[model samples]
Target: MAKRQPRDTLPTHIAQWRDQVRRDYGIEDAPGLILLEQAALALHRAEQARELLAKDGLVTRDRFDQPKPHPAAVIARDAEASFRAALRDLQLDVEPARPVGRPPGV
Candidate 1:
């Protein structure tokens, strides 16, 4: 059997975030990057959890046929909370994403 490569754990958007952080705050240090990584990981986890919830539905039946909330819901909720806290702690003061295409007054 061929040896499987280890999974890449880095967030897909880390580069974009890093660039913004560097441009806006001049933070190119280990601590800042670590915090950013944490935030990104939390967001990734939350997204994955949400996907699972969507696939499984919001509520599911147990072995007893009793309806219960999808377990992924909690994971998504907690991960989202973690992402928010990490962003807050980073203190980058990022602006909200602007609407795409066309200038507002053009």
Candidate 2:
């Protein structure tokens, strides 16, 4: 018989991501939960991108044509961007992604 890999465990990145929700955010509320959900989604997306990119950038192909711009890459990138935007919007003076420009009137 051959040894089989363990299937009762999550991937490394997925484990870390799930662990993040265990942090104490002082007050437990819907907003906090929402943040965690958003973070998880972002992490998932980034992981997808990493996996796709690691595959020699070939992604997928068919007998007729090959997809350009990398479909997975686009999805992952968009998910990451959406996550960042959502996180920024949920800002309660926490890690705000500052815009590099003059504030309205220069």
Candidate 3:
């Protein structure tokens, strides 16, 4: 059997960094807010790429494959939302998602 990769690594890092940054800056929201905003943008770009790939029929799998958002996009959005929610819980302002324009051919 293949060994499973650890799932909690990134979240652990994020939480550790968030705490460190908070302590260093003496501000509750400084770095966490920034990280969340960055993560959100990454997610948006990833989602766009996934849409593009799907439109172009580049990704395929057997019928038994459960449909999922393209991996990168899913990771990005999940990370972004998780961080954003954390920031919100701490009362930080999070930028909303901007609408993406249609692709050139569409």
Best by lDDT: 1
Deviation of model 1 at 52, angstroms: 1.1
TM-score of each: 0.69, 0.54, 0.34
lDDT of 3 by residue, 1-106 (tens): 9999864233445456655646764664556566544544444554555666667555445578965445554554665566566567655556776669976787
| TM-score for predicted model 3 compared with the true structure | 0.34
Candidate 2 weakest lDDT stretch, 10 residues: 18-27
Off by over 4 Å in 3: 1-7, 10-16, 24-60, 64-72, 95-106
Per-residue lDDT for 78 in model 2? 83
lDDT score at residue 90, model 3, on the 0-100 scale: 51
User: What is the full ranking by TM-score, best candidate first?
Assistant: 1, 2, 3
Of 2 and 3, the candidate ahead on TM-score is 2
Instruction: Report residue 19 deviation for candidate 2 (angstroms).
Output: 4.8
> What would the per-residue lDDT of candidate 1 be over residues 45-91, giving only the tens digit for each residue?
88889889888899989999999999899999999888888778889
Off by over 4 Å in 2: 1-24, 56-67, 92-106
Q: Report the alpha-carbon TM-score of model 2 versus the true structure.
A: 0.54
lDDT of each: 0.79, 0.64, 0.56
RMSD of 2: 7.2
1-106: candidate 2 lDDT, tens digit per residue: 9999764344677657545543544425677666656666676777777787777484566556865556777877887887677556555344657898888877
Best candidate per TM-score, number? 1
